[model samples]
Target: MPGFTLHPFTLLTASTVFMILPVTVQPAITTPINAALHAVAGPSDATDRYRALVRRLADNDPRWEVQTAAWSALISDVPTAVTDFLSPGGGYEKARARASQNASRNALVISRTISTTTATTSPIVHLTAIRASYGTLAEKDRYVRTGLKEAQDLDAKHSPVEQARQQAQQDRDYVADIALHGSGAWVRAAAQRAIQKSTDNDIQEFFKYSWASAAGCDLQAFRMNLVEQDLAYRHRLAQLIVLAQQAQHAYEQASEAAKAKAAAEARLAWSTAADTAAATQASWLANQQLAAAQAQSWQQVHDFAVTASTQQDWPTIADNAAGTSGSWSDEVAWAQSQAAEWTAVYESAKASADALPGANPTVSPSPTA
Candidate 1:
């Protein structure tokens, strides 16, 4: 009697009476959902007929509150079942999924930030490059014009060719100096563009670290523009230098022409003066010779007159000299006449000597006259 077991129906009724409605409802699972649900529902609700019975109870049971409560508890157990289901895939897969989601979100945030930063800063970078290029070009152009003006002024002032040449050389050197800067800018631009375009390790690393910084891509356009400006400036400078050189060359040639003209004029003047001097000397010499000949002819005439008068054979001399006259009186008269004519000729010679440009005439007749 002490070890006797109760009848099955009595045991069932007693179990039902003692059974408190569980707070949690068992999940009406068609099959084993997972371990958590399995503990609550047992294997009974896993079959289709049991799930139908539970549903029928939910719809028609007199104690709806208790039945709903039971079902609710069963439904609440599904979260644990889901947790159990995830177990087969391993914790690593879940961890990997979580990591992937986090990484994607972070990457999206970074991409948006970078894109926004790029959008905001790109215009500024472009503007800065443009301004730099424009400024450089302007400065270079100004210098070129200034140099050209200076060359023009110097030439206008009749500066010496050597001085002008020096100025031109200085201009050329200045252009050369600027050319280096321009060329350097161009070279740097190319280098920057290359960096931007490269797929090298260094560039990738740079991009990785430069998330909040300027990209090589942004700098390339600026560099290229600057270099273009520099080259233009250099070209302008070269043109200026050429102009200055040309001006200097023209000045030198003009100077040479002026000097040649002056020299030629001087030679012409010297030749004219020499010819005048030669003519004057020759005229003076010719005058002197003519005066000497006139004096000699007068002396010969006077000597002949004196000899005839002294001979007193003047009648015979006269007869011979006259060739058709006859008397001693006539002869005396003719001799006196001849003497007077000789004296007259001598007086005329004396007057001519006095008329000479620098003459000092001292006239005395020969004793025969």
Candidate 2:
């Protein structure tokens, strides 16, 4: 009774009531099984059964950390351990419990991340995390591992941090260009002072964030001085027109680049969602099957106990069988919940993929004189 579960039936006073059903003699039991049915099996053909279990576990849910751990433990070290592991109250149940814990933690992590991240400007990370959160345990863990870093990289393309850096660099170029070619004396002085600063932050700050406004000051002075229309004014005005046109060209280029990046990001997100959904779906199916097998196995044990078929083996397994049925039922519900999560992710990703626009043809460059 040390390791056995304490179900009501397990506490039955009469020896006749404690009898285990020996229904495992049927070899391939069809009567709903209770894993207490493990009393029927022996090692005569365990080699074939072991290999079969390996294939079943591998093909069904190879990405499962539990499966991976089992592989590592049994693959090279002790092939013979498979029989005991698959038996009632064996490694299989323990692994299932661990997987359940992992699934619970995954739900918590994904929920927190989903709440923190929104589908605003840069949605790749948000949606990607959303889908992976609902994916298989392996996929969910992957988000916590490398997927988060990858999302950050993708988000950084247009993220505030990266955008700020880009703007600072753009402003530096703008100031240098204005100082050399277009600005009047006052604006040129301002631009030069910014460029000459010891820290790059000064230039970035002067151009954008802090005290001196890049456009309000320099462009105003250039426009004001150009209106005089003297020989110097005319030359500077022509330069300013050229700079304006250049700015327009740069705007169009940035627009096209942004479009392309969005399309590519959307495509990748859809693909990830699709793939994760498929894998999670497969995991759901595998879990379903395992739960069904447990259910049937429990049924067999319950029936065997009622009829008092094999009183000799009853004491050996009575305690373990007490709660196996409940655990099997719980596994079925867990699998269904995971399946629903996968479905939600797949549908959301599919809709987003359909809604996103594709890349457009490149625009022709401006004609030269």
Candidate 3:
């Protein structure tokens, strides 16, 4: 645990899981959808095809409310029900839509169930819940019917203590990644200490409470780095101003033959600096606007999550909302800092260019992003 290091992208995977959940496509009972679609092609063949479709619908293993409706059609007058089931906007399509609605509601319940402390503590259930939360409606339907039992069976293979031991190894891999790539020295140290403790309780502590402390430490480090960068930018500008003054003086004192060339070179140097600085300034301004928009987008997500908690009672939305808020908030801070820094650089460069000899100070770089 002392020197554990993982690839940097390992943390990217660790942090963003819902974006990349594994999809296991289970084989369905054959001909279900095809049987429905082709059931009423013509009156001659409709009888056989309708029976085939009914059998297929009946055979859905983890079928939702749709199967019950299919049974209703099966028990009624066969010829009339068959046509009704097969025609456009008919019994089969309505059943499926109802099933989809049921699946959606089940997905919400499953999300809240797995986010419960008892369930979240189990790694297998946690994994299953993530798949259900981000998965499609069909996937959620299958998960609601079968995935919970599968997760429970997997969890039963080991004692709770053993499961926790296995989970600690996974957490160690994540903490090791943080130790290497986390923003501040303090955060890295905090990650390292969690890895060294090598206990399930300690790792849980790190995830639950210590992560906020580490983030606070990184905030201080970020501010310090911003100051360092701003000071370096100003010092570079000071150097450029001094060079421009020295070149102007040199051009004035140059002999007749060299004065023209000297003046030309000084003007070119200051003009190029102004051009480069202005380009950087515009780039940062655009980046600032983009960052602000991203922050606003995350705020919308947070608002939706709040609404979901009340309307749908989905508590799990809060975790994703909080993570996106923190990440986008960083973007907002960086954009603001860089935009201000580059504006200063551009102003200094422009002033130096204007004071240089033999340059048309009125000529400015185009202000375009």
| Clash count, one per candidate | 5, 8, 0
Judged by whole-model lDDT over C-alpha atoms, candidate 2 comes out at: 0.44
lDDT (tens digit, per residue) of candidate 2 on 248-331: 344445566576665656555444444444455555656555455544444444444444432123432333343555555655
| Candidate lDDT (C-alpha), each | 0.30, 0.44, 0.51
Most TM-score-accurate candidate: 3
Candidate 1 vs 3: which has more lDDT: 3
Candidate 1 on 126-188: residue-level lDDT in tens? 222222222222222332335334544554565543211112222222223322321123322
Model 1 steric clash pairs: 24-73, 25-73, 25-74, 26-74, 27-74
- Deviation in Å, model 2, residue 227 alpha carbon: 84
Q: Rank the candidates by TM-score, best first.
A: 3, 2, 1
Instruction: Supply candidate 1's per-residue lDDT for 327.
Output: 20
Query: lDDT score of model 1?
Result: 0.30
Better of 2 and 3 by TM-score: 3
RMSD from true fold, candidate 3: 25.7
